[model samples]
Target: MKLARATFTPGVLGGPGFFGGMFELPGGYLKPVLVSSCDGVGTKLKIASVMGKHDTVGMDIVNHSVDDILTCGAAPLFFLDYIAMGKLDSALVADIVKGLSTACQEVGCALIGGETAEMPGLYHGKDYDLAGFIVGIVEKDRIVNGLTIKPGDAVLGLPSSGLHTNGYSLARRVLGETPEALSKVYPGFDRSIGEVLLAPHVSYFKTLQPVMSDVKGLAHITGGGFTDNIPRSLPEGVSVRINTGTWDVPPVFELIQSLGQVAPEEMFRVFNMGIGMTVFVDPSHVSTMLAAMPQARVIGEVTAEAGRKVEIV
Candidate 1:
């Protein structure tokens, strides 16, 4: 695990002690555009609080924000974070920053600076909230915004780390948050429920960089799951048909559904079910995309449908 420090980036002018981080765009790119995205760990932090684990949620905030901007084919440059707590717990703050630095190194992003606040009234004891902001660069000609997506374009599925920082409020509602409940190892699960739910969000920046040209559009399946998210990348008069059977849904999702009796559609609407990020490509590039990324699955196709944004069949 590496820390985001000046050692990794001496070119960074003002880092920890300055009012802001200063960066110059690295040489050798043409018409580069900066893409930025921000996100929080959400109620998923509640699980981390209950479990007494602080670091993974830090990774969650960075990875989640990084992936959001990655949809437009951006490479992370620098990241800043906001961690708010009731009291300034030095050990806990250090643990959280440790996770953020490790994730920054993993994505080749600089952890420039951040803010930590201790508000006794706003936040309860030991409870904290985490959010991250990331800025990335991409060539103007290389932005993948799905404008070229057509009816026959093939869809590719990228698997998710369980939960991946979304739908936690509902997840906590269905799955008890008590110490005993979090520790329960369901029949099909090897790790306890808490461990599965707290798995850090996956960052697609490194994995998809090489194959980005093979894709015409990208969608990061986050808060809205398929129904609300897939459409953001789609052109009008066209919708996606997701082949749910194409990949295996993780067991934790099944546990949440079974315990809560959540409807099938609601489950898909809330959690990712399985797929995290989706890649759209010309039908001709299906083989090329899958060959380049073996872990990806051909899970759906675009159709000439107007009313619905996504159809899970």
Candidate 2:
């Protein structure tokens, strides 16, 4: 509690005296709608625990939650975290907080508050769980709900750093669960499996902030991969046709597939394959959007399809 109060200070966050701290928003929004999302690091935490790495997991939760609200064109205001463990280790807790503060500062979000619980029976020795909740604001008129998305709109993809806090359950099974196995370098990857697996989730806020107005829809590729997530942003009667040959599939994904003998179709469904976030925009704005995000690729296009939401070819 002291840490939260000191970190979130007065003026930036609501001062002490209420059950929850207050967040004051500066005027400018015509029809401000508060967007909130909560997400956890999932089984990826198991990898962290095994590796004794807790810092980046904080970023994993924050970035995951941020992207969730970012889909609606919202700017994050504040973030709260929940840490539950069997025992409280000051050093471990501090490391986690350091990561949380770093990510929150990077994205201009306040680490307003958090909860840390020490439950012996609930969690095993030295084990912990991490979750984050974020609140952001977007003008009602400016929300990117995909309702305006039409056929022929271009779908641009933003590349991911690595797994980005998803697919660890299967990754571990494919790569092997032993610590030595995780530390071993794979055929194509320069870094160990642990390093690639623990890469911090990338926040698209900075890249997308300038082009939010031009974007008709946004999808953050996480657990569901392209198949499930892209559909979330599609309107009725429209579907996205992705050209599988448009972008290079990251080597790590290829390594996982070959090692696990995972089928091609399941690879796209379970993993990002390469792209992390997808942006749907007017065909004419493709160059401008690409200029704003040079790393993004013109991966696909939206088409008139009665029932399908996404098609990878």
Candidate 3:
């Protein structure tokens, strides 16, 4: 297993120091429970592929996998990645590994190993894709599967780091890849198009882990945005009512909305907009969770309805 390497990004927040440090399995634990999740970076890779950058893709995979299991109240133990490409460039591969190593260290998980398949004729030359699998553990009683999400439960929304690995296909259509276009800067952007598109995926393991027990349901706002993913963690006769003006939508999303002529409903359906993860928590403990995670805001409340839905007020 030749783990992919990443470009050495030197800083306290770069590699091992990026996260709080490695975490050990809980000692004196009864019935060690294992949880796992597998996800790819989705067509967001198209932007990276067009930009000829590969380092951050590895971090994207790591963060996304970590969030998946964190929703189930699992602490990430280790991560494995799969990178397939038409050809292998040592520099590109190194960049991927470096990002993975940095992200793994940050989240206190081990980047034990991974695979790099150099399959010619499979992927187009100069094109690659990433998928990751993560394993984590928790006590049997600590899993958060939404069974406890009641009608009065509060929904807290965590701000995202831009797009975070979803809705790129449409994003690309709205914002294409010409040298001039990629080099130009938006009004509020201090970075160029490539820079924004390559921004690392946000990891929530440390942010959400401590409060998972109090969380009745955890929703990772991904592909279907809040509209689709939130319902998966919801129980029957319950839905979420989202307050639309609770947080400022990131400008990048606004760019997509304006350029794509995307309806508010479709925008929520495709992108995180700004909020990445929504947590359904007890009304009483909502303040505690919010205090622990200052970035999280009360976006909505759970409700009993005919079907699962997200009403964006």
Candidate 4:
């Protein structure tokens, strides 16, 4: 209760109720829409349990949910989490909550409330699952839904921090389940496989804040990777042409592909490969967008191609 109260601002969220909590948003908008998203850490939690690393996964769920809402040009207002485990461990719960608080503070979102379940039969051993729900607000006219995307609009790729909470199931299978397999030193990467795979998912709220108005579309590269996620923001009759070699593919992806003997096309379809987010910008605003995000690169462009929604060259 204290932790939840600490995350709320006085005017935004209402006082607690007997049955449930109250959330109050100040009213004064020409057009306001509430955008909500729910996401989980997936099989990444298995690796976290194996390694006994609980702190970063909290941020993973929060960041992942924030990015989903961000795709609709919304600013996060509050976040709620769900934690289920075989048995409740106070220390583990606190560590996870600490991470949630830290991430929510960074993104300026409130950790309003959450549920923790202790189900000995449902979950086995120390295993637990995490899910996050976030709500944000966006003005109607300010929403970027790729309707403005044109054939010549530039596609900018935002670098990802490793897998970014996706592809862990395939990665684990390829790397093996034992600690020795995870600890083995792979060529090209200075850190162990565990370290690289555990990198926190980057939140684009801060990076895209300045250029949100300039973006025609935004895609949060999650489960679908480039093939599926990018098309979500693309309008009808338009498609994306991505130049795969534009940016250096991270070594972790290379190792996964090599060891798993996964097809090149499948790699782009499964993992983020390298780019975590994709933004469509008008040719005129490309320079300004680039200036705001120096790390972004021109990985592709919008096209008027028929049938195909995304193409990787």
The clash count of every prediction, one per candidate, is: 0, 0, 11, 0
Clashing pairs in 1: none
What are the per-residue Cα lDDT tens digits for candidate 1 across 33-150? Answer: 9999888889999899889888998888888888888999889998888878888887888888888988988988888777777788999877888888989999999998999999
Which segments of candidate 3 are over 4 A away from where they belong? Answer: 1-27
Ranking by TM-score: 2, 1, 4, 3
User: Over the stretch 1-313, how does candidate 2's per-residue lDDT look in tens digits?
Assistant: 2233236733475566532467888699988999999888999888887788889998889888988999999999998888888877878888888889889998899888887777889999878888889999999988889889999999999999889988888999998767898799877778888888889889899999998989999989999889899988888888889999899888889989998999987888888888889999999999999998999999999999967568888
Q: List the RMSD of every prediction in angstroms.
A: 2.8, 1.8, 5.2, 2.2
Q: Which segments of candidate 2 are over 4 A away from where they belong? A: 1-6, 14-20
Cα lDDT for residue 28, model 1?
Answer: 75
TM-score for each of the candidates = 0.95, 0.96, 0.90, 0.94
Q: What is residue 261's positional error in candidate 2, in angstroms?
A: 0.8
| lDDT score of residue 283 within candidate 3 | 96
Extract clashing residue pairs from model 2.
Answer: none
